[model samples]
Target chain A: MITSIIINGILIGLIYALLAIGLTVIFGVMRIINMFHGEAVMLGMYAAFVLFDKFGISPYISVFLTAPIFFVLGSIIYKFLIDPIPAREREITSLIITLGISFIFATSAMYIWSADYRTVTLPFSQDVMVFIKTRIGYPALISSCMSAVMIVGFYLFMSKTYMGRAIRATELDKDTASVMGVNVKWISIATFGIGVVLAAMAGGILSPIFYIYPFVGSNFVIKAFTIVVLGGMGSVTGALVGGIILGVAEALASTFLEYSMKDIMAFILFLGILLFKPSGILGGRTRL
Target chain B: MFFKILSSVLFLLLLFSQVSYGAGTFKIGCPAPMTGPGANFGEKFKKAYTMAADEINAKGGVNGTKLELVFEDTQAKPALAVSSAKKLISSDNVIALLGGWSSGVAFAVAPVALDNKTPYLLEHPALDDITRKNNDYVFRLQPTTGMYSAALEDFILKVVYPKEKKKQLTVAYIYVDNAFGQGVAKYGIIPFFKKNKDKFNLVVSESYNENAMDYKPLLLKVKNAAPDIVVLTSYLTDGILLAKQIKEVGLQAKMFTGTGAGHSMQDIYEKSGKATEKYFSSGPWHGEIKDANWKKWRSAWEKKYKYVPGEHEVEGYVAIQVLAEALKGVKSSDVVKQREELKASLKALNMKTIFGTVKFDNFDGYTNQNKAYKMTAVAQWINGKLLQVWPKEAAEREPAY
Candidate 1:
């Protein structure tokens, strides 16, 4: 029973990490806290649902298509919505702007999709593979593995590539990076696009496990924010670790204690981590 | 010149009388969540109201005075429902109010309807307190949550879970924390747990917010508890989400019953895919009602909507049809006069509804009428089709899974 909980916790944690990575990147590089991050995820799910419903595209393939489309969408949002705010007032102004964007996106989504719950069914939707008397969902395996790959790919992209170095430099010191001929505008757009792409990728994978509704983003935003805080704000690795911690805590709480206690567990972990580590498990002094 | 003056005066008097009599248009206001999380129920109410009003109009307009329906979109918010009710009464000049889906929205509009001295013919709001404490102005067409819970409990006890072999009786309850969920918990689930304490063990009980997307934690907890039955008292979106998760987790529960008749929708089956076939729920109305009148109504409604009348649509239609019968029986268009006559007629009514006979007992133009609230045939998804499963007399097919 304990082994199963741990495995389930790890799987759920990995998925949360994947979901939170894009939000963290957007915050770290662009310094814009996107309130619409979850909406981007929901939109990706809807994209997959439309594909499956209309053309019978496999969810796995839909993920690849959705990610790039959402990347461009994120770039467009950054250009139009976030670019207008002055740099000095970007902190407060960006919140309202992104909030406005979130509401607009959510409303437009409702108008287009009609707020109905949609889902994609894969061959493994209900298939359970038992390993040594422990049962795991087949799609859950796909979600976790995909999340891990994305996290690693994200780290490598940030560390090795030229654009990646620019993003990291900007995260470290925006003024310095801009002075070093970084074309900070493009970097911001690229970072925002990557963040949105990650969100979309998570959505595509997670939608099969969770139902798709226009308002689904509302719940995710809360968890994603909690995860960001728990992981240490502005830290990519922190967000990933925070995601896993929260997921595992939730699984454990629901397993031993009451399921209702999971929310309380999240808050407690957030506070405990803040008070004790001050920086998250993998988080450094730099803002995530 | 004197003859001309007399003719002019007579014409003027006739015009004045016509204008005053024309004021008896009798507007019934429909305020529902036409756009929001709870919009499906609202849409059903809207369709049913339109069908009723159109039919009434064709039959010479509700006792010679037209039934003017003014629909206000409240978006399922309490503040909006209140504001919409005020506008409908004060600005739109509606004589009475009719439709609402959520109990919170209904409660918000109820006081407004009362303060304005207008009768509110509540179509589908099912909070117990709405009917229990009693105001004379609020008239609910559907049964309250308490009534539904009680009837459902009785049905389950007498029909589903017989006492002779009461083994494997454990329940896990998950619901949204709003009025709809609370009412089901307070009236339906809590009582069942209380009475059948020896027979049933409640392993898990949790409440989630309305727009909940991730139910994995909840599903995991329920599965760990090892329940033979899972009772979910949630509406549309969450209903499908939770069911999907349950299938994903592979909990081999004998019965998964939802409080509302949500599984009947094509959207649910379409989204849930094969997952829906294992789901069972109770709705107020079933298309396969064996009665001849019900069959006729079902055929016509199916042809028109491309879908059979669900519980909400059927109840909404029945509410209007009963109102029509009452108006016809009383032969009055006066708003105040019709209110009284309709109340009395509804209380004493045993009219055949589209689903079955609607007979209200102690139905005091107020609360807990019809003690005769039907069990509402149990329907299950069979090969993605929602088929009737209970009361073998009416059932078209055997219960699958």
Candidate 2:
């Protein structure tokens, strides 16, 4: 039982880490928390559901379809809604606009789907792997692996590519990047799009692992924010580490204490960490 | 010219009065969650209410007035329910109030009925206090948590354990931490445990929020405890999530049971696939009730709605039937007198309906709780279909596993 709890904790942590990476990247460049981050996750889940419902494609394959589509949707949203406002009004304006966008997305999904809770039983949904008499869900394990791959891939893209360099430059200092001919506007839009793509990827992988509802993304949004703060708001590695810590902590708490206390304990720990660090675990590191 | 103008004004007043009073259309206010988390059931209840109203109108309206069921969307919130109830009473000028899916929503609207002296008929809420508060107008049809728990204890002792021939019983009770879930689990299990401590041991009794997306940690605990039966009290989505997780976590038990929310739903059959086979959910209203009128009504409903009857559908149909019975025999067109008459009729009524005899008995501090032996049916999922398993007379097939 102890071994299983440990394994489940790590697996849950990895998935959470993937979800947080999106929020962290978006916040890193935009400096505006996308209130609709959860809605992006919902979109990914819904995309996977549609693929399965309409075309009989596995969510595993639908992740590829959803990521690109999410990229385009995210870019379109930023261009139409977030780009119109001046920098002075961007913070509060983006918050209100994205909140409205969030409602539009959720209410649209509800209207199209009629607020029904949807779940898909994949061929491997019930598959399990046994390790030291501890059974682990293979779907969950697959999701963790997928999340890890995405995080690493995201890290590489942000570090190695020319566009990645431009994005980081803009995130550091938009005026400086503009003086260096970085096309800061395009970088901002593309970075937001990439952040959304990453969120969709995480959502697609976790779709079969959880119930799909119009409001499902909101459940993960809070956790993602916690991970962003825990890992240091803009730090890639921090999000990963924070996610693992939070997930494992929740697993242990639920196992030892009351199950309902898992989330509460996580938030308490988050507040404690913020009370001391203020900036976050790696806030002073000065590097992603 | 003055006489002609005066005569025309008199005609206008008389016409308006006839339209308002002589129309013979009695409006009944109702609130259900039509757009929020409870929309699935609320829409189903709406359809049932419409069907019942149509049927009653077809069969020569109640005392020459067609019953008009005015449904308002509560969104399953207390504040919204209270607002809708107030609007339904004042704006709509409904003679009686009916319908609510949650206890909190029902309780929110209870005051409106009490203050206005309108007959409050509830279909989904099962909280004992909704009817127990000595409110003359409030009448509930759903079996209370206490009543449901009593049935569970009776079945567990008399039929389930003996039929399985288990020397001892260990039950893992996982329920949604809401008014309905906690009320029954807290009140039901304690008394049953005290009475039969030698026979049954409650290994796990935990409550989780309804929006809970994960159950692995809780299921892991249940696996370690290794209870004989895994009993869950949850709504639709969480029920499916928990059932699937139960299989994934490999929580082995003699049998799996649920408290008539998601486990008893058609969604479970469609969504959970084979994971739900042999699972049991206890509640009132089964598709296979075998009652003659129920069969006819179910057939008519399927033909009209092109789907099987959900719990909300069944309850809506019965509550309206009860309301129609209460509304019968009003000779005057006065809405206030009609409200008083309906309340009295509902209080004194002892008649058979699809849900058994519709009678509200004032007992044990409750002013108008139906004492006509509320039968709670235990429906078991077998090969993707749910059939009544407990109360052997109502069981279409024996429960497996």
Question: Please, what is the whole-model Cα lDDT of each candidate in the order they appear?
Answer: 0.74, 0.81
lDDT of candidate 2 over A210-277, digit per residue (tens) = 87877777788888999888888878888888888888888888889998888787888799888998
Which sections of candidate 1 miss by over 4 Å? A271-288, B1-25, B149-168, B201-221, B322-352, B355-372, B392-394, B397-401
User: Per-residue lDDT tens digits of candidate 1, residues A86-155?
Assistant: 8899978888888888778877888898756677778668788876555777878887888888788888
Question: What digit string (tens of lDDT, one per residue) describes model 1 on residues B78-165?
Answer: 9998999988877766666776788888878878866776767665787767766466566665666655554346546666567436
Residue A278 alpha-carbon offset, candidate 1, angstroms: 6.9
Give DockQ for candidates 1 onward, in order: 0.34, 0.56
Quote the true-contact fraction of every model. 0.47, 0.64
Clashing pairs in 2: A231-A238
